[model samples]
Target: MAVTRSLSTLIFDLGNVVITWDPRPALPEQYTGQDAEDLLTRLDFFTRNADHDAGKPFAEWVADLRSSGDAEGADALQHYVDHFDRSLVGLVRGTSQLIDDLKAAGVTLYALTNWSAETFHHAQAAAPALAQFDDILVSGEEGIAKPNPEIYTRALERWDLDVRTTGFLDDSEANIAGAESVGLTTHLFTNAVDARAWARDMTGAAGV
Candidate 1:
């Protein structure tokens, strides 16, 4: 018979998994529908945002846009910075309860997230449940984003966690793959209910 190791520690991904992020609301009212889609395309939003998550300052990005004769894009980016709080829609449904239950059960908890250092405060302010984590590792702060094996290794080393006993929960398939590469048990989170079941099985925590 094979025996399974119980997960004593859990590393959670904040975006989507804990906090819901929707940039649409952050745009000016005029940039609605196709205008919004076009604006994002013009600015290469996702790629540039990834650079921000990897520690590139927003000012630098805005400057680059301005220099490229993209004043509109630059202003929009600034607006996003000024009103970043609006982008954090809310907490993922049922995650706060799960976090509370896990904490009550004495499971060590930590957070690993890909987020801009300049704007992470918005998420912090919006999600009170985030305070439950023992620690949080932000990609922007570390200058290393997810899907990078080094960050996962750093998380393990920083927390003195045994990979075999730690489980990682993330919404990104790439991030989950990275955690698996590091030999940590992983759950690709879709919703809190499924996550609760996985947590219960891994931790044997009652009422998870």
Candidate 2:
């Protein structure tokens, strides 16, 4: 499928889109089975974790949880800090190749990720594919996060890119909608195979 959209910029979301990240590996071993599921449910990782991405003081948050008598929760958060690198399992299959293809196609690439600045250091060193991007906008550093219109505007302003010709790829429905609200051509990412095909069609960057 070809879009004939004349895309000049391709914006990518990092976690689960370009790289595989899961906090389960960093969680304590004892929290398993139903208990583990309960812990996850109780913690509300995505919602609570957003605080971290929004530049909240990590130590203060943990201390507050501990002071509230949720020592186990505090320990879990600490475990995340300690084993942060482990959370990034590896690159998402085939995205590195797709990024190379986009670069080879002369499309300017940039990253808009709702990741904590503290944890993103591992990617700068371990994920070579990220190096292909012209620049990366991290929520933690920006003190804002996705599904927020401001961050999208900030990305566009920072890169001096036109929203009409830019394409965005992300796994979250809310984030995709947020990009659409800001006038970015959006793709809801599922896997690299489909993403590559969509990108090729969208950007007219069809060659290997």
Best by lDDT: 1
Off by over 4 Å in 2: 1-3
Model 1 residue 32 lDDT?
87
71-190: candidate 2 lDDT, tens digit per residue: 998898788788888778889999999999899988899999998878889877658999999999999999999999999999999999999899999999999999999999999999
Give Cα-based local distance difference scores for all models: 0.93, 0.88
- lDDT value for model 1: 0.93
Candidate 2: worst 10 consecutive residues by lDDT? Answer: 1-10
The TM-score of predicted model 1 comes to 0.97
User: Model 1, range 70-174, lDDT digits (tens) per residue?
Assistant: 898999989988888888898899999999999999999999999999999888789998999999999999999999999999999999999999999999999
Count of steric clashes across candidates, in order: 0, 0
Models 1 onward score TM values of 0.97, 0.94
RMSD of 2: 1.8
Candidate 1 ranges beyond 4 A from true positions: 1-3
User: What's the true lDDT of residue 38 in model 2?
Assistant: 81
